[model samples]
Target: MGTAILSGIISSQGSGSGTQEIDLLPTRFIACVRRPESEDAIRSKLPREAPDSTVSVYVKDNCAAAREADVILLACQPHLYKPLLLESGICTALKGKPIISVLAGVTSNEITHQLCQTAKTESKGVYDTDAFSVIRAMPNIASAVQASSTVLEIHPRPQLKGVIATAHAIFSCVGTVFTTKPGNFAACTTLNGSTPAFFAMVIDGLVDGAVALGLSHTEATQMAAATMRGTADLIMSGKSTLDLRYEVACPGGATIQGLQVLEEARTRAVWMRAMAAATSGQSSLKEGLKMSRGGF
Candidate 1:
């Protein structure tokens, strides 16, 4: 996720200053990993051969790294978070730090309670200081290329203004960012996060249709992709999708003829039904607050 965000930032901002600009920035990053091999793999992908930024990559356990960090990011699998934070000494280290958990289905309230319990057991103060913040974010695969549409829900904190700004700046480098309520976070996931898969399926269908009509697989795919790209550009050029469809359906033209067949088959309805099924399943999981250890 971090690498994805970095790539987005680099793509949008153009690689120039190396790490000088990052170091001069107010925010500092410390990545905590469980294994040395993981750290080495992460290091091998740095923007520059050896960038000079305050972003330290620690190969120690979570507990050790959580001690000195002000804002801790939890990127482990959802199922592992509860047990890891409880069993690892890391919970004790996060005495008054803000936590940004990326685990889906795990609520901010749950995270707050778990950390608070750990703090109490360790004789530390309650995890309710002005600096003690928690936020939940949903970022899709595009984050790797810095072209993701990231959604964030931050728990209210007095000292979080700067942090929020920093987060926005960082995420904006990758793509777009939207602030939303935690309750709606899952909806955003279904809309923007899952839409890529939906689009891919649509493209696949189009390509298959072209191949069935005697076009080579590669040629069909390229043509379908370019057509979709052009269509998207047209829609983005200030026209409603429906309006654009009508514009393309020139009076009694081939486009209109094909559209009529699609309409007769209730193609639009079929698409809607598919989306409804996906949205319903997502809504059920979110309403139940069930945490699963799986990728989105």
Candidate 2:
């Protein structure tokens, strides 16, 4: 997560023309933690010239890192989140700090519950579990290149108002940000996290068809990619998808022929079904999270 988000920030600020600097992103220092064995590999993945003055890595010392940082990102795998939160004392260390989770399917309530459990066991006054400030976020892998679409959800609280700005600022460095209610988080995950992979497949399929028509694979892929980008830009510029399709597909042109093929294959239905499947699967994932609370 550090590599992904940090790479995007570095790209947006370092190379993206006309991109504005994210003021909420820390410029002074960053504390990153990873497994001891992964320290070198993770460090190698970091940007050579990150905007932050220092990025200190703590191996297998999540609590130390949490204690040192004002904002803590729990970006571990979904399965590992429970263990990391419960076993590491990191939740206790988080205390009143902002904890943003990028773990898929793990809700903010689950995080708060685990923190309260940890506090009860530890008998520590370090954490105020009843008023945990947790945020759930879904940002795509495209963040590595400063093109992700991120969705965030924070349980409404007065304390979280300012936290949203910080969250928005941090994510905006990578790409556009959208705020969603907790009820819509799973749907947002399918949109932001899964849609990019699905669109990549669409792009590749277009490239394959182009190659079949005698275009070089590289040439076809570049054209298809550029077309997708331009189409999105057009849509954002106030042209509806249907209007754009109508504009491109003349009465009996090649574009209309291609669209007819897609229509015959029920392409729109297929996409809708895919999204429905992902959204439906969230319930099972939530159940699994509950059953696997003790460990990964």
Q: Pick the candidate with the highest lDDT.
A: 2
lDDT of each: 0.65, 0.75
> Can you write out model 1's per-residue Cα lDDT over 232-277, one digit (the tens) per residue?
7787688898899888899979999988988999988987786666
lDDT of 2 by residue, 1-296 (tens): 55687667665666643135355676443545555656566557667766335566677777777777888777776766667777656656887878888777778888888887777677745545545688888888888877888998966688887677777888888888999999999889898887877899999998998899999999998999999999988987999988888999999889899999999999999999999887776655544444332111
Q: Estimate each model's TM-score.
A: 0.75, 0.88
Model 1 clashes, total count: 4
Question: Candidate 1, which ten residues in sequence have the lowest lDDT sum?
Answer: 17-26
- In TM-score terms, candidate 2 sits at 0.88
**Local error of candidate 2 at 210, Å?**
1.0
